[model samples]
Target: MLESLTPFETVLVAGASRGVGREIARILQPNFTVKALLRSNIAVNELEVLGIQPIMGDAMIPEQLDLSGIDAVISTIGGLPGDIKRADDEGNRNLIDAARKAGVKKFVLVTSIGCGDSVVALPPRALEALGAVLEDKEKAEQHLIDSGLTYTIVRPGGLKSEPATGTGFLTEDPKISGSIHRADVADLVCKCLISDRANQKILSALDRNQMFSASEIVEFIP
Candidate 1:
């Protein structure tokens, strides 16, 4: 097991502005000092209100990042509707390089399902719809896996906006396609950041039969 994180430990949560990223910072803030990297001033101010140390920088430019004393990092970095391939790949590459330069040891990447050869792991039509996204996610995942750092790549299924209970299940080799609440995804990222079970692994997860607790989900993580 990884050492339990103390309140004094520092975490650099990249993309901690909205969606799963913001939620991850929220869950971890009560436990550790969290540095929230964001692009927008409004977003930075918003997280500042929640007691997160706001660091303004774009993932595409890692040289500007200064996580010198950070203990761990979790990146929910992603691209929007179009330009998914270029943006996501570039941003992730920058994050990986920056983490290495910052000397951060543990890294957790919030990637999507169907990355790498896992693209074909999805139904054909589904793959077609998300071809560009999956390809870029594949590149990013490979970069992390090859980074020579203790890393965990979380491939969460579809995301929804809902209340989180810190519950979910791993669906590695999932035959039944489904989604998970974004809040749950954030909690999962936070748990993985602190758990050795999540070290150096690629995991796919979604809500299956029941709402599994964070520890339970990590123990059974794929």
Candidate 2:
């Protein structure tokens, strides 16, 4: 049977406006005091309705992060296309520096599977498609890994907007990769935060059923 460790009192979800970050805040709401780090006032009302405290801040600006008194930080921030300066690379580094200063217990980073030495996890075409964006994510991953903070780096395979399948799994094998729902990633992030086993581990998140299959895994994600 699955179990949960003692939950942290306060947790911050950077990039909480949408995508994976929004889901992380939603999953952490039941037991933890969830804080949503948003860039503008656009998401404030929605986050408030979800029972999350919205903090107006931008991850791109490192100095804006007032991480004082926060227990943990889950960063799901990524860059948009065609931007010479990428948020995935520098934005995350800023968060790490701030987290280190605040003495946060755990910094959970949600990156993609092909980051760093895990390039084996993706096909050549995918890498070609991502290009510099993937490179930026790799740099961010390395920055977090080298920050000396207790961190769990989660590299998910292709992310789907589907609901939680409850079948997501984590593995150290970089060669293993596939598609997984964003909600499932949020579920695993919640689990990883409270589990001592996940500390300092660089894990790949994927649906177990899609782990191996040449024909299927290639076109697994849209």
Candidate 3:
């Protein structure tokens, strides 16, 4: 027998204007009503086509979020160049405070693999080029862990736009690395929202030699 932790309901998808965030909202539409938060009108048009309610809120400005009736939140927001910490760390704090005020609890944060190490996993040149975005992401992850909210952190390896591989893996340790299709990462995130088993776990998502259904993925929660 299967028991669900919470009813599938409205979700707020930060950064949903593009990439994994957008796809995640699309895939979850049938089962969950999504509020797609983005900073621009261009993104609003794309989400509106998919029947998503577009909310104009930059992760950098969390007070702008209208989180009423939001059952859960999935944030794929990232920062680059001179804006990583401002975007990820400060932005996340703002978002979390807003969610807390709204009485929303469940959260799934999309972060990167190898963000917390003394040395970033990516090549120094790549880090420099991105201006150390991972450092900001790492700080955001720690903030969530310390936020006293029910949370799950997903640290994924290189992100690609390929179709879901239909097979994926997770690790407690962050040493493993591989690329993952954006769709699979999205699916994993939605699954976490409804999974009681996933609470308070930090799981690394990667493409590996394993086959599992979305339900099976919940077992990876530690």
Indicate the residue-level lDDT of 7 in model 3: 59
| Top candidate by TM-score | 2
For model 2, where is the 10-residue window of minimal lDDT?
A: 213-222
Order of models, best TM-score first = 2, 1, 3
Per-residue lDDT over 1-222 for candidate 1, one digit per residue giving the tens place of the 0 to 100 score: 223453228988888889988988888887788898877787867898889999878787766776788888898888754662454678888888888877787889988877764464467787888778777777888898888878988888778888874566654452434578888887677767776777887777677644222323333552
Instruction: Estimate the TM-score for candidate 3.
Output: 0.84
Residue 128, candidate 2: C-alpha displacement in angstroms:
0.9
Candidate 2, which segments miss by more than 4 Å at Cα?
A: 1-7, 212-222
Task: Please give the lDDT score for candidate 1.
Answer: 0.75
Per-candidate TM equals 0.86, 0.91, 0.84
Candidate 3 residue lDDT tens string, 1-222: 112336547889888888888877887776667888777888777788899998787777656876879878889887666552456777777787777777776888988876775234456665566546776788888888887888888887778898898665666654455678888888777777777778888888877643222222333743
| Counted clashes in each candidate structure | 0, 0, 0
Task: Tell me the tens digit of each residue's lDDT in model 2 across 1-222.
Answer: 223345468999998899889988987887788999888899999999999999988888987998998989999998865777778988899999999999898899998998887898788998898868888898988898889999898889889998889888887778877899998888888778888888888888888765655433221210
For residue 66, model 3's alpha carbon misses the true position, in angstroms, by 3.2
lDDT of each: 0.75, 0.84, 0.74
lDDT of 3 at 120: 41
